[model samples]
Target: MRLWQRIFLIGLVLWLATVVVTNWTGNSNLVPTVVLFGSFLVPVTFVVWAYGRGRSPRVTVELLFVAFVVGGALGVLGASLLESWLVHPSIGMYVVVGLIEEGVKLAALMFVTRHMTKRTTMDGVILGATVGFGFAAFESAGYAFNALFTSEGLSLRQLVETEVLRGILAPVGHGLWTAILGGVLFAAAGRLTTTVMLSYLGVSLLHALWDSMNAIAIAVTLALTGHAWQFALLRIGRVPHVTEWQVHVYTLVNWAGLVAISLVALCWLWMTVRSGRRRREILSQ
Candidate 1:
């Protein structure tokens, strides 16, 4: 089997084993192991796959590992610090978050790959995705850790659910967004071109929309079901109890929005990769 396949299979087995042991033994000590495995499994697999795809001379395994660990660490730290200081709960909060997070991921990518002389769009995609996946892995681990605590006590089920959900959506989230930005950045050959700026804004918009999807789905469901009064309740720190039908509608809307966003990002990445390959071919000829 390929490296990515091996990584995913082994990681999944380890995660499952950890979960079973934790459940059987009721050991809180193994919670961290479960969280780390579940959180990092998909991201590590994707990074390995991307690394295989590029197979660039300059982008060695060691460099990719550094980018994944150090770059991801830097991105999450920078984003957390900036978001904590600057962001307030508001309508535009997701937008600000998107801008800040994407900015930081780009910065981390640049910081890690700055010394490389021959940068290409593919290289950027691989490395940027490495950093992004790194961020996702770390951030998901944090989320899983937080999910362990609830109003009552430690909730392993919630932690597993959070990790599973985030793991499933990992590829289309940070990794996809940063891959687009990275492709554009490298296509410009490190220049701050208009194309690069536009790509950043586009990805940031996608990020914002993604972050706000839950709220958007709730609002849309409320509107569709003629529950406009719930909006007022929401404003005054009241969460109106939703009906079964409303819950179904909300879930549908939420998944639909996520699918739409994922499709858009995937298409953008495909086009960007195609364009980059064509450009490279032209240059070679």
Candidate 2:
């Protein structure tokens, strides 16, 4: 009924229609069409949801745009540089990537909000959602592009599949984590305190777990398949043939891990919002 809800519904319908049409026609030309639509669907919906959730003093359109566009671009660029320089094929690589990414996003949040004299927790939530979704959109685009290529050739199906999966998972990923960090950062009122550092570390750990789920699943599968689970397994390409039972077990564990991590992140975000609301209420009293 609200504007954001209506917009999200419309976007969803349009995205579904595009997917149907593109797949029916089997036109490679429409690859980009579906990719962009599907990639933005989840991020946009979550952003609208965040905007509607914070019915308080609204964040300005200009600031939200800067956070979504400029902040997102900066996050991607910074994360890429840090990941390239510091990350390698290792069990711990996901942790490093998570720390770098969440760190850069927080920096981007500060960059966008630095000029403001008064910022509230809600402002951080909305702006943080914008920046996170922006990062999601850009990162999804890159993943979609890469999905087009495979061992065989151009794979439109794979591209669409990648977009859809990432889009579905986008909300609980970057956006949620950043919102938690942003809420804490703003509550700190620019103070470098232990609480802020701990919050950042917590979100970074969530990010690491989210990113490392697949690797963890594989390790578990390998162990069950009688292959000794080693950190080296993570660095190797093309897992040795897994049994059908092992495959099923891995799939179940992988999906469960994903869902568990998402629920944890969502719980953290909900707690942050509740705490922020309480703080505001007490301040007003």
Candidate 3:
């Protein structure tokens, strides 16, 4: 079967699993709805968009699709299993989860991208992002659904807010991060022996670091406040002054930073192929 066909099949099966689980519970939730849509549709659209932009390989798109499904499944399972062991609501939990999820997704990426006939730095980044995007989409949706079920008739606003934020800021949990890893691995496919291992570990560590920062902040606040109630009331009750009247200034700032980093990453990825593409075109001419 074609690579694109394989990706499509995996995506279909993943979507079906999402539906089956929701049906089994007989409960509908907003986040789940968002996850169902974002996890399944976002990557689909991304592949289309990437193709339309003339950046991604259509023939190998199937590999990306498979990466998304397989990695996404592992992420969900890892996050759930780790959540159970999160006895201390500290940076440790978040870091551990981020590492596990990213690690799982990256592993899947390596498997799918292995020994391919055509390999490029951009292709690696694109595939890695595809995996991350799939994982983040479903996870975000699952969270949204849980929120809706516990509250009023669907937290549409929250769902939109998280989706928009994550979608724009972080396509997959560790999207921009993993893209760097994939790019490196792809470039060193034939030249290096231990580069792939180093790249994977580096990406995973960065992911864990990002999550740990947030976890530490929350943990510190909880500890200093002496009580969760006081922490919620006194610390969270007050909103600081900041520029931009956008939704959740804090979130926007974080997203902005993430996007900025992504821009740098993109520049690096573009450069990796620039000379190569130019060389190819020159030869053809």
Best by TM-score: 1
TM-score of 1: 0.96
Candidates 1 and 3 compared by lDDT, better number: 1
Model 3, position 119, has a per-residue lDDT of 67
True-structure lDDT of candidate 3:
0.58
Clashes of 3: 6
User: How does each model score on lDDT?
Assistant: 0.93, 0.83, 0.58
Which regions of candidate 2 are displaced past 4 Å?
Answer: 20-29, 224-239
Please write out the lDDT profile of model 1 over residues 1-285, one tens digit for every residue: 998999999999999999999999999999999999999999999999998888889889999999999999999999999999999999899999999999999889888888888888999899889999999999999999999999999999999999999999999999999999888899888666999888888999999999999999988988898466777788899978888999999999999999999999999999999999999999999
- Candidate 3 lDDT over 48-151, as tens digits, reads 45444446543265666677777666766766776676525663665566566666666666766665766666676677676666676667667655545434
lDDT of 2 at 35: 75
- Clashing pairs for model 1 are none
Q: Order of candidates by lDDT, top first? A: 1, 2, 3
Evaluate residue 158 in candidate 3 and report its C-alpha lDDT on the 0 to 100 scale. Answer: 59
Residue range 152-251, candidate 2, lDDT tens digits? 9887778878987897788788998898888888878855589888988988998899888888998787776645544355458545556688879889
What TM-score does each of the candidates earn? 0.96, 0.89, 0.61
TM match of model 3 to true structure: 0.61
